[model samples]
Structures are given as structure tokens and as C-alpha cells.
Target: MECLASLRTRVHPVVVSAQIASALYDTGLQMVVKERCSDNSTATEEDRQKAISNFYMTYTMLSSLLPFVPAYFLTRYGDRGFRKVPIGIPLLGYLISRTLLLLVILLELPIEVMFGGAVVYGLCGGYSSYWAGVMALESASSQKERRSLCIMGIELAYGIAGFVGSLSSGHIFQIHAIGNKNGVVLVAFCIFLYFLCIIYTFFILVIPGTSAGNVEHRQEGNVGILWNIVEYPRSCNIVIVLLFISAILYDIAVAGGMEMLMSFIMKEPLNWGADQVGYSNAAGFVIFFTSFFGVWLFSKFVADAAMIMIGMVSFAAGIYFMSFVTATYLFYLARSLTLFALIPMPTIRSLLSKQVQPSSYGKILISLQLSFTLASLIYSPIYTKVYQSTLSWFPGFVFLLSSIITVLAIIPISMVGWRMARQEGYVSIEGD
Candidate 1:
């Protein structure tokens, strides 16, 4: 009875951790930028832009590159017996990183030291393993028919928590009670929250019995992980492959575009303060809720592939609008236009989940994560460099490029839709 109760009460720690981490990382990075660039009265605008760009690039590179191996092992081995290890390890990494940030602030250490923190975090599984664990747990626990809703619910929880945390983070950082040094109070709160997540994940959370054991018998063979990777694509249908590719492209475009947006808002025409940054981030989180609603509403009548196509169109339009953004109101307008933008990735994930066998969830998610990380490896440095080079002439060029990439994402999604229709034996009528 006690075990059943625990299982009933289980909620993924990633929800809270993602929220707190987003708030802390966003505000914390801003503080780092201010200290590195603006704090020196002698620093020129060019100096500040270069400093911020270099710091973010270094952090992105390290964070994305270091996690691949550990994350792969965690996801692969996790299916064997150690389910919680994937979630716990990343949470531990988060704790260490947040602690390091606090110490960096209180001890007046160099902002570059945060690179070490990123390394520690990445080595422990980072976002890839953490999120994959969350998805795997949800996929295992919920009925197949309800899995899509369950995943979307998780995203909604993550988004709402992020919205609340971001809304308050700016105020928390500005609190004068913690001395004149910025982000001390905010970092302290982050540390406390991370600590709570670690405790709850280690002690309280439970995986339900339904998905607890390795139901799919692996007795057929002990093919090594490398062989399994080589076999994965050959095993999957072309539709699944295209779906995976579409998901990867959308993620890369969104990530690269947002990275540029972060740096963009910090500079010239819109020199966003911490409060403005908080509000902007809050607005971004609002998309999660809006997207959830969009998915729920659209799922009633539209095919998943069609829904994804709509989302891609919305995102492309939003990015196009963002390219012309000069005022804060226009920024908000651009965000509003993308309210349905959050739909594609989750929908793509849902489509992919439906295509795979139950036992393959961990492997499939790991593949998706690897693709996302690989895309980051290519896009982050390129986007940062492009942003820096065009800082004086066309800062919005990245957004235009993002819009183009999103439009291109529509191709694979369209193919998936056509495949689905054919599989369903539905004949297309021209101008019907």
C-alpha cells in the first residue's frame, strides 16, 4: 500500500529543476555579462558584445559537447535496471553547478569559472538524459492512448513553473537585503531549490509498477550498443526517419534562433534590463501553455502531422516578424505570433513515440537527444559568429535564417502526412 501510494504520488523532478534552472541560468548569465562587460566603465559597446558572445559560445560548446557519452550510457543502461539514475545524476549535476554559481558570486570569482560548472553538469547527463528519463517514465506509466497528453502535461508543468520562476527571478535578484551584489539572492534561491529537487528525487519519487520492469525480453541477443545503433535506422521505416529528421531541424532552428535572440536583446536597440529579461522569458514560457492548448484543441480534428505543419508555419511567421522587431512591443508581438510555435517538437515526439515499440522508447529518445545535441554543435558557434559579425548592420539576420530553416522543416512533415494518409488508405482529392 505504501509503495502504491508512492507510485501514485510520483512527479518527475525535471519539471521543477527545469523551471529553477531556467530562471537561475538566465538571470545568472545576465549578471555574468554585466560583471564582465558593463561593470567596467571603461568598456566599449564592442568590448561588451565580444565578451558576452565569447562567454556564451564557450559555455554552449562545453555544455552541449560534454554530455553525449554520459547521457548515452545513462539512457542505454537505464533501461536495464537503473531508471532513476538518469534523473538523479543530472539533478546532482545541477546542484553542483548552482552551488558553484553561488560561490562565484559570493567569493568574487571570475565569470569564466562557470565553464567548469557547465563541464560538471554535462558530464553528469545534462538536459538530454534528464529529459529522456522524464519522457521514458511518462511513456512507461501512461496508457498508449494517453501518452501524448501525458507528455504535453509534463511540458505544461515545466512551462508554468518556468513562467512563475522567471516572473519572480528578476525581483529576487534585485533584492537589496542580500547586499549590493546582484544575483546573490537569486543564486541562493536556486541553490535551495536545487537541493530540494535532489532530496525529492532521491528519496520520494517512485516509478510505477506498470513500467517498472524490463517487459521486453532481451534474451534474443546481447548485441553491443554500437550494433544496436547501426541496426536502429535499418529497422525503422522511412516515415520514422523523416519524423526524426524534422524534429531535429525544428529543434536546431529554435535553439539557434533563441540563442541569438538572447544576445540580441542584451544589446543596442533593446538593452534589456534584468526585469525585462525576466518578463521576456516569462512570455516565452507562456508558449508552452498556449501550445498545450493548441495541441489539445487541434488534436480533436487535425492529424498530428498536419498539426505539426501548422506549428511550423506559425513559428516561421513569428521568426519573420522578429526580424523586423525594433521596439519591445514588437518583440512581444513576435512572441505572440509564435504561441503555437511550441507545438511542433512535442507533436513530432508524439508521432515518433507512436511509431516505435515500447521497449525502444529509451533508445529512440536517446537518438533524438543526440541529434539535438549534434545540431547544437553545428548551429551554436555559427549563429553566435553570424550575430557578432552582423551586430552593426543586420542583427536580425539570424531570425530570418531561422524562419527559412523552419520553412524547410515543413517538407519532411508534409511527407509524413502523406505517408500517414496512404497508410490509412485515404485517397487525396484535388480541390476537394
Candidate 2:
């Protein structure tokens, strides 16, 4: 009974709510684009694709680029007061953005006006700060030995919520009783979820010993922003550096691929409707659960590096298969092949955490998030442009490029495994 109580207290409701909101937003945005693009009967397919591509690029660019500075400040100073500030601020942003979407649908505002919501979301710290605060809260609440388990638990909750939310969003969007707009019901649901997240974060959630006066101060003593970068690498060995490189590459590839995939599926070959898009997204979310299972099953026999390599290969192969997908079944098959696709990033993070001192984990992770955000800024435009340019002849080119980039990530992982094996003075039996 006490164990259950402890578990209940530790479970972050905001995480689940945030995941649901994200899934709804993802599934709903595509529906919104379809509605907006279809409004003009004379618009060609090419024009629709261009408009979709441009809308996504604009939203992605703003959300990714604007969050950097705010996230830095929030993560650095958030510990001074309520630890949940960083986490809660993003939820507030999510609520406002989702509410804006709902209003847009109700008021029949211009679709491009959603960019304003993205801007508001970005200025409020975005996912980078939110996730960082989540990790910090988990770390603070759990014992050192159980920290990883707590993190995994949080991820599992997120995945489950996303899975359910994505599956339902399509049907929700089809509901006609709500204001007669296409996705009004779905957007309203998202707004409600974000509101709950904000309320829970501020009122119901409790961080263990995280009171403003009780928080520990950084020992680095007001060092310049560049100090972490200059100092931390001195401590990281080749394996750590290689791990960082591989993680960043994988992040960029996944981000670009996902952004392109959403737009790609809505176009020529598949032309998926809202329901089909929901199921496709549900398949993607299932990767998280499958990856958790994969890690548990593989950890009994293989090293962490081996597990990461296997995941990378799975992603590469699945993406390669996706490049050939002309039918929905083939797309599902490709998604199935990548069931373990979610493993590498978390595994790499765990390995990197082991390499650095406890005090430096925040610095390392923040730096990683910055790298990912920067990569996102570049990749969104590049992938959008590539997809638009190749829309007529080879729309699958983006997926193929994603596959190639994923395969390239394996090189650094291999180097890291070899270096680690050498350092341990063992015969480097790959995947052993």
C-alpha cells in the first residue's frame, strides 16, 4: 500500500497529458492542412504540397529556433524557484496554442495564423526545456540506482498515452457536432488535455524536496555559457565523443524524416485521410513500447552498445523499406520493422550519463538538446525543400535520404563500441 502511494506520488500526470496533446496536435495538424488545402478546388496537387510544406517549415522553424534562448535561461535558473516552472511553462504554452487552434477552427481564421500559436509555444520554452525539467525531476525524486527505471517509466507512460491519443484523434476529428469545422472536436480535446496538464503541474504535482530554498546551487559558480562546452569535453574520452556524435546524427535524421514523412504521406501515393494518418501515427508511437521491450529482452544478453547498434540497423532498414512503400500495407510493414527504433537515443543518453560526473549530467543533456534544436532548424527547411523539389519524380527520396543518414550513424556507434572494448582490454567481439 505504501509502495503504491509512493508510486502514485512519483507519477507525473503532466507527462501523460503532454504526450496526448502532442499526438493530437500531430494528427490534427495534418487534418487541418488537408482542410485548408482543399478549400481551393482549383489548386493543383503541387500547390497543395507546396502550401503544406511551407506551413510545416514555418511552424517547425519558429518552434525550434525560438526556444533555444528561453530554454537555456529556464533550465539554468528554474532550479532557483519552483522546479516545475520550466515544465509548467511549456504546458501553459501548449494550452494556449491548442486553445488558439480551437479558436481558429471555430472562428474560421486563416490556417497560416496558426503560426502565431507556434510562436507562442516556442517562446514558452518548448519541448527542450520541458523534457529537461522532467528528467531533472525524475532524477531528484528517485534513488540513484532506480533513476534509469524512473526515466523509463516516464517514457512508458508517455508512449501509452500517445498511442491511445493518436488512435482516437482521427475519429475525434470526424465528429461533426462541434462547430461544423473539420477538426474542431479534436482541437478542443487537445486544449482540454493541455489545460489539465497545467492544472496538475501547478496544483496536484509535488516534487520531492524541490522547494525553492532547498534546491542545490550549481558549484561551477556563475561560469560563462561556453564554460561547459570547453571544460566537459576535456573529461570525455573517444567513446563519449563518438556517442555524442552518433546521438546528434540520429536525432537529426529522425526529426527530418518524421517531418517529411507526415507531409509525404498526405501527398501523391498514399493520400491518407485523417483515420489512416491516425493509425500510421499510432504505429510510430508503438515503437516506443516495442523499444522498451527490446531493451529489456536484449539487455539480458548483449551490451548497451550492441543494443544501440541493433536499433540503428532496425531504423535504417525500416526507413529503407519505407522508401519503397507504394501501398498502406507496405507502410505498416515498414513501421513494424522499426519497432525497436526508439532504443538508440535513450541508450546513448544512458551511456553518456555514465561517462560524465553526476554534476555534469544537466550540462551534457542541455548541450545535446541545443545540438538537436540547431539540427532541427537546418533539417526542416532542407527536408521540406527536398520533398517539394522531388514531389513529381521521386517523392520517396526523403525517406531514402533518411535511411542513408541512419545507416551512417552506425559508423560512430561502431567506433565507440570498439574504443570501449579496447579500453576494457577485452577481445572486441562485436555485439557480444
Candidate 3:
């Protein structure tokens, strides 16, 4: 009973539930967009592809663009002890947005109405506040030595949930609740799951007080400081700024490639059906597992930055390989090369958490996430446009572009590692 209570209080359940709901919602939206764009009697394949891609880019814009202020404020409050506010409000947004998708399916409304749903989602804080809050909580709960593992474990839970949800998402999209209608049941279940997430987060979830490791660090006044090189009352922390730039660049590479990968696989030689889409999404989730294990095993030998670089190389090689994949098996083969791709971001977040005082870590994380949202706003449309223009000439060009950018993203991390080595009193994270 004590163990059961402890388990219930942990955040893993919330991560699992929310990710499951997200998988269903994403698959539902994609299929709906595909159906609608392809329904026009005179529309060619390229026209359907362009239309679908346009909707996604626009939806991503609205969902990401408006969250900057609201998310900042939400995490600001979260940092000050209104912890649940940041998390609960975004779940509320998710519930509302998901409900809109359901209504679109049930009422046969124009798919463009989802743009409003994205606006509501962004205004309510979107992923920036929610993930920042979650990371802050996780960071506080774990010891410094175990922080990376603890956070990676949360990601593992998220990935497992996504995998299970996506594995069944396609079949669920075809299931009808009352009448024989597509996506009604799937979106309904997504709403139901978010409802559970909200309830669990608010009523049952327990926010842990600071763990001993972070407390000890707080007590170490200026002794183990990583950013001591920066003068006091500084205009900006250069290391943090560099970290943000690195994270955003990596996010651009990942998001741009994956966003277009959806449209790419949906058309032409692959022409993936709903089941294949489910399988492909499930394949993507597999990286979380691999990355967690990579961190666990690699941490014993290599530094955090090295682990991040390893992950980046894995992705760079894989995405570049993706540029040549002409068959479904080849696509999966390319994906297989990215087994460690998810490692870099979480490791980067862990590094960020350690750099700040506990009281101010939430702000830093939210700043990073908001920057990622901003990057998505800029890159989504560009990747879409590039994919459309190259559709006839070479559809996989964007993947190659992402690979090059991923390689570029590595330089900043290498700088950080070199700086750490050059700094006195720093262990440089080469081992242990």
C-alpha cells in the first residue's frame, strides 16, 4: 500500500497518460487533414500533399506562436511555488483543443477550425510551460548525480506511452463509437485520456520538495559554480545563451525533418496507410528507449556532452541516410540509425538545470522551450515550402538539409565542453 501510494504520487503516470492522448490526437488530425485535402475532385496528388502540409505548418504556427507570454508567466508562477498552475492549465488547453478536434470529426466542420484550437492551446501555455514545469519538478526530486537518469526515465515513460498509443492509433482511428464514422472514437478517447491527466495532475499528484543533492549544491556558495566566468549583474549568461542556441538549432533539425517526413512518407513510393503511419510513429518513439539506455550506459564512461554528441551524430547520420530511402524498409533502416537521437535534448536540459540556482531553473527551462517554439515557427513553413518545391525534383532534400544543420548544431556543444575543460575547478565531465 505504501508503494502503491508512492507510485500514485509520482509524475510518470501523468506523462504516460498525456503522451497517449497526444499520439491519438496527432494521428487523428493527420488523417483528417489527408482526407479533407484529398477529397477535392480536381485535386492532384501534389495538390493534396501541398494542402495537407500547409494546414500542418499553419496549425503549428498558431499553436507555437501565442504561447510565448502565457508560458513565461505560467512557469514564472510555477517557479514561485504555484507549481500545479503551469501544468494544470496546459492540460486544460489540451482538453479544450482535443475537444475541438472531436467536434470537427463529429460535425463534419471545416478542418481549418483547428487553427482556432491551436490558438486556444497556445494561449493556455502549450508545451513550453508544461514541459518546463515537469522538468523542474523532476529536477528537484532527484539527486544531482542521478538527475540525468531520473529525467531520462521520465522520457522513457513518455516514449513508452507514445509507442503504445501510436501502435494502436491507426486502428483506433478507424473505430466508430456509435455510427460508422472515422476518427470519432479516436479523438473521443484522446479527450477522455486528457481528462484523466488533468484529474490525476490536480487531485492526486504530489510535488516533491528539493532533494538532498540540489540542496547541497545550493549550500556550496560560489565554490562549484559552472558560470563563474561571467561577471555579476551580467547582461546575459554566455553559457546559457550558447546552450539555448544549440538546443534551438538541434530542435530545428529534428522538427523540420520529422514534420516533412510525415508528408514525405504519406505520398509517392511509400504512400503509407493508417497502419503504416502508426508503425512509423511507433518507430520514432523507440528512440526514447534507446536514448535512455544510451545515457545510462554512456554516463558510466563518457561525459554528458559526449553523450549528447553521440546522439547528434546518430541523428545526423540517420537523417542524411534518410535522404536516399526510396522504399519503406529503407525508411525504417534510416530510422534505425537514429536510435540515440533523443539523447541530446534531455541531456542538454539536465545540464541547464545544474547551471542555475534551483529557484531560477524553471525560468531557464521555459526560456529554452520558448526558444524552441520560436524556432518551430520559423522552420515549419520553410521546410514545407522547400519540400513542396522539391517534390518533383527530389523529395528528400529537406532531410539532407536537416542533416547538415544537425552537424552545425554540434559546434556549440563542443565549445561548451572545451570551455568546461579550460575552466579551473571544473571536473570537465570527462568521467564519473
Model number with the top lDDT:
3
Candidate 2 wrong stretches, greater than 4 Å? 1-5, 79-82, 140-149, 209-213, 218-237, 426-432
TM of each candidate vs. truth: 0.91, 0.90, 0.92
Worst-scoring 10-residue span by lDDT in model 2: 212-221
A best-first ranking of the candidates according to their lDDT comes to 3, 1, 2
Candidate 1 C-alpha lDDT tens digits along 279-298: 89898889889989988898
Model 1 gets an lDDT of 0.80
Q: On residues 46-105, what C-alpha lDDT tens digit does candidate 2 reach at each position?
A: 999888888899898888888898887777665553567778898888788888787777
Best candidate, TM-score: 3
Q: Give Cα-based local distance difference scores for all models.
A: 0.80, 0.79, 0.87
Compared to the true structure, candidate 1 yields what TM-score? 0.91
**lDDT against true structure, model 2:** 0.79
Better of 2 and 3 by lDDT: 3
- lDDT, candidate 2, residue 257? 88
